[model samples]
Target: MSNQDQELLIELQGQIDQLLESHELQDLTSWPTEGELDTLIAVEQGQAFHITLQRDPLPSIPLTVLQSSSVLQIKHMIRLQLEKMEKNKGRHRRISWKYIWRSYCLMFDHTKLSDDNAVVSQLGIKQDSVLRFSRLAHAKGHHRKAWRHR
Candidate 1:
């Protein structure tokens, strides 16, 4: 990446970090302590490979890293997850996710999720977890709700 791009990435990362601090739901035990970051440990087949953050964009983070990071916020995770799914599905569109849970699917006020600092472990989600995506909701935070339950 160019110097300008790198600087932009750093700034963006910092911004996101601040957002996580303010908006993420926290799981005290797993949350990032001090300077701890969301890091990636790569694997090859069934064997360990290397640890990496790959200098990738915030929206394109590796899932393994994301899953383990206690500091990474859910709102960001939702965006990355939706992006991952879109790539896997061979779609070239940016989108939001929504879930169907509790009695044939119910719409919810997800504005509260942004304020949660709960870590991924506390959130009970993982890479490749099957869920639905939606562009249905125009409200904040409900843009992409990872539907953990069916």
Candidate 2:
């Protein structure tokens, strides 16, 4: 990587650190706290610069880091990732609690509705009847409402 590219990666890592500190979500994972400088590899592939960000024991982030004179490219990349994560979350939220519970029961070889109430409570779901409907709301992309439900 060139000096300019290294500088850009360092800047991006700083921005990520700032974001994590501000969001207070860093405790959710051990990756961020393990290091100050997050080692990111930037590969120039054809016309695009592909950035591979390593996350501990999870998934690798493949981002096409754009080389542009425009000031908005960094902002654009952040926005794009945020939008993509939101969309992915929407898909996962679609998995109904009824389905989740059913699957949980089947997988664990457990039965008894009352004992499952704790799981439902953790999800802030009071009744079994509303599980599917609540998940549908989440699937429809009402994230705020879904969080409220939880």
Candidate 3:
């Protein structure tokens, strides 16, 4: 492996060790139809990954995952899904980038999610909802002087 790749691997292992200390392994009770690997976050590594455990095919049912999970968790899942899809097509994957939700005229208040920690039942996001998150726009407050000068 290249020197950079080796360095990244070491960094990832260190972060994983820290996360493992705080979070418990997911069980069926916590996550029904639990996957072999509890979806995990490696913040320092900027990666999220999981392995399926069930004998059944990986179900794409949003409700199953969203109902018991927090909105923040759903965001992670969406990132994970996108990462998997892009990787399959031979693209790079990283989940650390900022995001801004968009759909028509919908206003997304980042500080106040529809239900940040509530179950999806409370969120009311429809089945097959396709959330569109683009790169977050840079804050506009600081550039007012340039506009006034113009």
Candidate 4:
């Protein structure tokens, strides 16, 4: 790295170390998640630094620090990731649905209406409608296909 980059990294590391030392144990749990920290960095302008401390669900504590030498670069990275995630959300949701459908199908044979009826009843779906839809879903090879088109 160039001298400027090295200096920036050192400065950021020191800030992070100081934040970890100064924060109280109980306060670290409330700190934001890693994803949120990334968003904060992306939105900030100019040189930006954040030190978050939180305590919850554990006693040791949690601390996050992010420092960006160039606000524009940080923002660009965040924007790119956000856009990618937005594009993938639908695909992820479809994958989750397919997983649930396959698990249910495995537990109760889709070929038998009686087995499917049992699942529909348990899940509070209308028996007649659910059975027809479940059969169609299986016949159309819905679960057999990958969730993501590409």
Candidate 5:
């Protein structure tokens, strides 16, 4: 490896060592199957997995992310990947992250992942899991009218 790559690797190793020595990982024996610390260790060990993101009219997008990543982080990744795909196709569309979170619900295994702070592993999202996003009915500018009708 080049000198710069070697230096980067050493820096990463130091950070991993620091994290491994942190108080949260002290009780390895008590680590739960879906715990954040376990996911962190898996990420450090290069055990990240690929998940499929699907929405109607668009082909499924395969994304690889660390198991400890939060729903919010995954949303950000999805935005980035979408933008990249658009750019590759000679389009320049900028997706609003805030609007996305406000206007859509991401579902996994028929359950809405309502908590943005929830970790992927904790939500039971595993390798090959299919996450689907759908627009929220209330966010489509019909809530006021629907409420008035009610």
Candidate 6:
């Protein structure tokens, strides 16, 4: 990667980290404690596995994340993968991640992974599982309502 690309990645990572920290703080009731996450990660140290994120028109993105990782964390990983993919394609434009998150839901086997705090294993997401993005009801300029993902 070029020096410029490396710098862009670092900047984007920092922004995403800040966004996640603030998001966790906003949802304090569902957010896991650092110690708890550390313990879980330690227990699942050797259980990291790969999963694919598919969005048509773009090549499938393969990511390796811990089974104990939260859905939000998986989204963070996805954002990073997207950045890398763009860099590989020589496109340096910034992505509107906040907009994308608000407009799309990640689905596995047609089931929406709606709980940001839910762990991958809890959502039945295992090795080689494929997740796709689906537009939310309020993806466009419409009144958003509480829609349950069953």
- What is the TM-score of each predicted model, taking all chains together? 0.25, 0.24, 0.36, 0.20, 0.60, 0.62
lDDT of model 5, residue 18:
78
lDDT of 6 by residue, 1-150 (tens): 999999999999888667657744443224456844553454456666778999898789887778789999989988987886788789998888987999898999999988899998888988789999988774366776777879
Which candidate number maximizes lDDT?
6
**Clashing pairs for predicted structure model 5, backbone only:** none
Give the alpha carbon lDDT tens digit for every residue of 1-150 in model 4. 899999999999888767756643223324546765554454354223332211133222112223322322322333344455557565332235344344433112234332322322333322112111132245554556556877
Q: After superposing candidate 4, which stretches have Cα over 4 Å from the reference? A: 24-32, 35-150
lDDT of 2 by residue, 1-150 (tens): 999999999999998777767644543333533322221221122322444433346454444433331223422343455466768678433335344433322111122232422332233322111111011223364444223443
Worst 10 residues of 4 by lDDT: 125-134
- lDDT tens readout by residue for model 1, 23-119: 3323222345442232321222322212122222333233333443342243355456556577888997834333221112111122122223445
Q: What order do candidates take by TM-score, descending?
A: 6, 5, 3, 1, 2, 4
TM-score of 3: 0.36
TM-score-best of 5 and 6: 6
Q: Mind giving the per-residue lDDT tens digits that candidate 5 earns over 27-72?
A: 3433234544555566557777778999778799877678788998
State in Å the error of residue 32, model 3: 16
Identify the leading candidate in terms of TM-score: 6
Any idea how many clashes model 2 has? 0
- Could you give me the TM-score of model 1 versus the true structure? 0.25
TM-score computed on alpha carbons, candidate 6: 0.62
**Candidate 5 colliding pairs, count:** 0
